[model samples]
Target: MSELHNHADRVLSVVESSSAAALSRLAASWRRSLVRHGIDPATVQGPQRLTQRELNVLVESNDSFLRSATPRVDNLYALVGQSGCAVLLTDARGIVLQHRVNDGDAEVFSDWGLWSGGNWSEEAEGTNGIGTCLAERRRVTIHRDDHFIARNTGLSCMDAPIFGPNGQLLGALDVSSARSDQTEGFNQLISAMVEQTARQIETDFFRATFPKARIIVAGDDTREGSLLAVDQDDLVVGATRLARAALDLPTEGELRPIPAVDLLGRSEESPKGFEGAERAAVMRALSRADGNVSAAAKALGIGRATMYRRMKRLGISEKSH
Candidate 1:
């Protein structure tokens, strides 16, 4: 504990003297955040959560994200529960939309202001994982003593941003532990796991939003990239952050109407040609229509006989309800 105090003192000195060059980039950034939020590192207090009514309004406004993130957050909690970690799903604004904490540790975490409907934005809480990740728009692990606030020195947190099908910031996935040892490097492992889970949530959101589009899982290692939503004409209609990054797709501006060949490294001449694309489109349409051949065919703007012929040629067996 004395060591944490010393580190905090050093950080305060750096912030006071504007000598952040001595600290690592991450630590220096935290000091900057402290300055930006007008938080005194030396005399920081615990965070204040929203009132019951305000929290309720915030939660209700984010109903869609809550529904999409609940299962993923629950599964993550189950995986990390043994480690005394709490998993949180927060909206883009850093309001905790969903959280999982073991019953035994509930009181301790609640005392730390780590609970559902709690606000952990960078402006509210000095430099923790969920808030900082949302502020920086990146994955980060703020380990013990790395937080700007001395009051939160006992906590360690890893967080990753989750993007929606439209490439908007949906929220963040966070894994936090009350006890973290910097030397143990447990937080590093936790960071990787949380990032993977965040990607999964993003991919699921993309698929849910574009069930009728050909969901292309493309990358050097396809599973690494978030799924991409391609239209019947081989246009990129939607992409996950991972997909955008992996395929070197546009990071900014609209992504739709972008050519699939440009992103997927394949064309009509390739063995996996337009034939595969058509097959994927047909299957997705059928799936979206719930195996109603007439509806699926109409959605594809084709007659029923043509649809069945294409499905047969593509070896796609359909129930044809």
Candidate 2:
């Protein structure tokens, strides 16, 4: 037999040799163990019938060039396959389109008895992010006990609602995982996975809408910052000198007025002052303000609200002078 085949056979043999009682006890132990890990019992949302329009659109998108370029967005379940989390994708109509459980996680998740075609509405799944985002059409993160199901209290999920060309509600994307890692901060891993999935979706959208364009306007993009695109909007639909000032892009300080689009393909292998500039902005502003936020706001050419919000977002805090 081929080496790969032999490997597979060995794995199968190991699995097959496992006793039936062992499996039963394992399943039983996992049921409550997952609960202790934060699987909200009440919010164990399953799948539901999708609307005709929603199904048609998703089916088309699933077969589009975007799918060819980036399969994970539509291959929602596959992305998180057996990683101890579940990835769900829904349509504009609150119908669940695709669902996938992380590898090795299927057994634990199946304990919640959440299957395909389950409805996750507050009326059904209650207050959970996936169902709630679909119901409210917003981005949300649902943690333990937030789910309607008391037994589902062990799961934490981060979800974001998607949009189409018309800014129409397209669907919801989410990552659901056991809350055991929350103490270790690896729960952030799930959030990062969701963000990557979102980025792929956005990238596909950009490629489809502007096939000939090289620039991308990924708003608040993660690679470096936001992306810039040059459409026929007449106005420069991208970052301004203020943004350049905030990020302290060294190239810009050198008199190069790089638009957001220019940075799309620019990888962060070089000394791109992302971290330094971010910290410098506060230091420079605070220095100018002598630690007075109101003064810093004026000097930074932003509103006080904007200044405070940035500070909070950046984890910067100081006593008001």
Query: What are the root-mean-square deviations of the candidates from the true structure over C-alphas?
Result: 8.3, 16.8
TM-score of 1: 0.76
Alpha-carbon runs more than 4 Å astray in model 1: 1-7, 16-23, 180-183, 219-223, 252-254, 268-321
Task: Please report how far candidate 1 places residue 123 from its true position, in Å.
Answer: 1.5
- Model 1 lDDT per residue over 1-321, tens place: 566577678777766564535456665566656767876665546676778888888889877666767788888888998778999898898888777888998998999888877888888877889888988899998887778777887888999998876677878899988965434377888899899888878777778877888886764646754677776555567777777777777764455455566666674232267787676577657755767888989999999999989888988777531
| lDDT against true structure, model 2 | 0.51
Give per-residue lDDT, candidate 2, residue 281: 58
Q: Name the weakest run of 10 consecutive residues (lDDT summed) in model 2.
A: 233-242
How far off is residue 289 in model 1, in Å?
30
User: Could you give candidate 2's per-residue lDDT for residues 42-103 as a string of tens digits?
Assistant: 22235344456755676676554335334765465555554566776655544555667655
Ten consecutive residues with minimal summed lDDT in candidate 1?
A: 262-271
User: Which whole-number lDDT from 0 to 100 does residue 311 have in model 1?
Assistant: 84
Model 2 TM-score on a 0 to 1 scale = 0.46
Estimate the TM-score of every prediction.
0.76, 0.46
